[model samples]
Target chain A: MANNHAGLPSPTLGDLVLPKLYSLFGIANKDSLYGAVAEFEDGPQLVAAGAKVKEAGYTKLDALSPFPVHGIDDAIGVPRSILGFIVICIAFCGTFAAFLLMWYTGAYSGPQIPGCELVGLCSYPLVIGGKPLFHWVFGLPIMFELSILFAAFASVIGMFALNGLPRMHHPTFNYSGIHRATDDRFMLVVEASDPKFKAEETLELLRSLGAVHAELVEDK
Target chain B: MAGHHHDHAVDSYQLDPGKWSTGRNVLAFIALLSWALLGFGYFNDHERFFQSYLVAFCMGTFIILGATFFVYVQYLTGSAWSVPIRRILENIMVSIPIGALLFIPIAFAGVDDLYKWAKPEAISDALIQAKKAFLNVGGFRLRAGILFALWSIWAFAIWTSSTKQDKTKSIEQMKTSSRWAAPGLLVVCLTGCLAAFEWIMSLDPHWYSTIFGLYCMAGGCVAMWATVTLISLGFRSNGVLANTITVEHYHDLGKWMFALSVFWTYLAASQYLLIWYASIPEETIYYKERMHGSWAWVSVLLPIGRFVVPFALLVGRSAKRNLKVLRIAAIWILFMEFVDMYWMIMPNFHEYAHGFHLHWLDLAALGGVFSVYGLVFWSRFKSNSLVVEGDMRFEQGLHFHQV
Candidate 1:
């Protein structure tokens, strides 16, 4: 089952790195650190640094921060979060559910008492105090609640589902520096993912700047 | 940031990470004294419900405990909109024990005025008697204790970890806090419902509402935000919080206030419609009491005053983004929340009291509640870093909250 057919799938990070070079030699000692990995302190500073890094004909960079740093979306050259798209989709389903529930309960399903008026066992809106059923007066609260309830459920459910919540494992934990993620420290670690990644040049670029420390953390 | 340090006359800016301890101490002293006087007056004036004093006491306790736990939660999660003003929330939550302590006599008074379930003779309804498994005094107190304990444990988790993180700066602690929070919030909401049921809703033995729990929560969430925003404004206006809290932050807060205000209205309407449509003998009577017999005016006015008018004021973008508008809207909503609570709770107790009842005790109680909250919140704000300086979000907040 393990080794049935074709050569192993497209290279994971483990395949790309020379473990000995990363471990004993470190970033500066490497022949091509430019594409390997570059580290920065935190998000905003990284974002600021990243924009500059991005401008310097360097298309290969990534960043990690403790909290969301605004503009990082543009700076790091990552596309906008698909979370919102998921949110929109989830919100639609939630709203539909709410509408269906009420429609089913109120209009479709009858505890269906025999009424002075009936829309075929569906609950028809009564003209109470001259307020129209579809009007804002009657419709607003449910619509708003339905939208919000769905959105709320979708937001939490979407965030978890997208992020894979209740998740007990992550590759980032392999990096010791990442431990500072919950605290004051922010970091920008350029991955080997980018095509321009030449490990030596990347390390040179990072060291030339004000980086207090330069080291590689195994993404492998 | 380099060479930007200004030492001119020592422009006094120190992050009083928390204001709760001082606020709690002061509030405790005052609350104990005032509650004592009220307790004495309550004992002398009317023996109808010896436990009635506990109602006021619980309000104070719940406010303090409720508010602080809410604050701890918002911070623990790194909630940015609330980051600037959370210390006050911490203060409010901590002050609950003070209220609990003050309510000791009331708790001791048994079910006298607090609940009809305490007096078994008064509860003839076979159905209500069946619920005694849950609605009993022993069960009620245990739940209350568990609720308070959970809150205290939560508060302490924040207090200990936050203070510990001040020096240690453990990322694990922050993650630990975040991990604990979701469950903690669930527990709090659940306890909050049972607490409301035990402390407020059960005042009338026969009456019950399933949505009552959500109703109380929606009100609590909104009111907590309003009070915190108002206090944040006070701190900002006085140059206390300064750039740490700004209109952008207020904008976000206003959005939440507006969102939750709508939530309250939804819950309120759902509960009303469910009970009204069901038209059951017991359930309909709950609405019947308020929807008619002079209380009807309040029922009518609630939608307009509570939902419609404030909803209108909050809808526009300018109101959310501008501090002046946010403040006005907050104050309006705050007043309305007070009214809304009275509408929900007082109807059960006063029964016949319609419109608004202006009592000196009401004023005193309201003042004590606010003043104690203010004093406690500010003091709590002083004790800890008003912001989670260690938070991954702190730098973003600096940019966001910057004027």
Candidate 2:
């Protein structure tokens, strides 16, 4: 069984089922570089290095730290997220949907008979405690709750969507020392796709910015 | 204290007496004019005067309670961001003793005129009769006295401890204030609730909602943050503490104002929804009166003006950080708070219950009470540093930042 799983593994049903399985598996195009990564002593050093890298005209950079380092966003020139706008839009849609649901069930009353020739579908009008059949006052609670529900869902889903999440694997994981980022080390990765990235110059830049060690990351 | 050296855009925390006195004198003038109008309204219409005065009194009382709550919370949380703005809250909190004096007219003179439960004839009603023990004028006055004393003692204890820290710069002063904060918050919350019940809820003796106190406190909380935001903005424009309190602090203040306004709306909705759903006469009558005639306009405007408008205005990151937006939002929230107070109190009066009357006395009494409140706040302002200069977290607050 170990021999069967070892070496260049034999193709299985996944290869036939998922035509792009190799790319999606994050193991593809061997000899292609992902990025150059550097480790730093601490948060401040990482922040300073981020600024230096940005000054060196590298636009595509990411940092990993055990905790949030203040001023990192500004140093790296990160744009503000559009998650709030998305949430509000989704929340308004939720509000409208909630009102529509309540109105159809609690307020709308049309002839139920198929041949009645009415303009709208039949609904059982609920008049509890003598309240009007379709008052926003009564409908407000559900509308408010649904808006929150949708906004909350949007907040989580929108955050993930913006971050391009659900990614099974990441290039940075190829670096053996990456786990130290969760402990004491601070790491910065300059993507190979950056316009200014040249492997030798990038490695030199990282070493100049007080990196304890610098190396290349690979996709496979 | 030794490490408290840093250069900033603004040099001093001391108020320029000449400049601020001009503002105080303007408040004093407004007070005198409004009080004169109140006096005229009193002799002109006895009943209207009490109703309007009660509204103003409740607004001032709630704001003070809110300030007390805000100050104590900061102490308990050991919040570094609030240290720079804590003195403003402390001034507002310490000024709370004046609420006792403000409550005098309501207690001694306006009770029978304002509260249905206080009148001998009203006691004949079964509902009022049942509430007679808690709603009687004597018990009301006694409770008001004790509650005010409790709040004053708590406010002063924390205030003196904090102010002494301005001189002492010792961690012990911080400890003492924090020590008082835990119990002080409980007492304030409880007494504030009872005060709301006894003072405002008893206006409609036949109606009651268990969430009424929280509803009132929520509005006050919103008003308190708005008041703080306005004062801080005012100081910045006047070039005092211009650098000490930054946009980050305003952002936090704006967040508070935004959040509490939503909280106030939540409480309001909870109360209204339960009453509407149950459709019981006694509980529903409160909203019934509010939703009828011209009063209905205010009822509609109350939620939209208080919640929707402010929520939209302050929801964005840029809006909270923008001083112009914050100033507009603060003033609007303060206006809405008064509107809420008016909505709660004015609907109880039978004549005004049928029609929303923006009586001249309403404006006068509001101005009169607020100016007096401002004057007391101004007096405290003169005697202390504009910020908590000696706080252990003063440096942290001075350089506070938010992304």
**Candidate 2 at residue B104, lDDT?**
89
| Tens-digit lDDT track of model 1 for A58-156 | 665666666777676677687545665666566667656666645554445335556624545456545554433333334445765677677787788
Docking class of 1: incorrect
Best by TM-score: 2
Tens-place lDDT per residue, model 2, B125-195, is 98777777877888999999999999999999999998899989999999999999999999999998998
- Model 2 chain A weakest lDDT span, ten residues long: A1-10
DockQ of 2: 0.21
Alpha-carbon lDDT of model 1: 0.62
Query: Each prediction's DockQ?
Result: 0.03, 0.21
lDDT tens digits, residues A1-220, model 2?
1336457666777656563455457755456798999999988888889988999899999999998987778777787889989999999999998899788777767656574337554567877767788888778889999999999999999999898777666778888799999999999999999999999999999999899999998766
TM-score of chain B of 2: 0.97
Using lDDT as the measure, the top candidate is 2
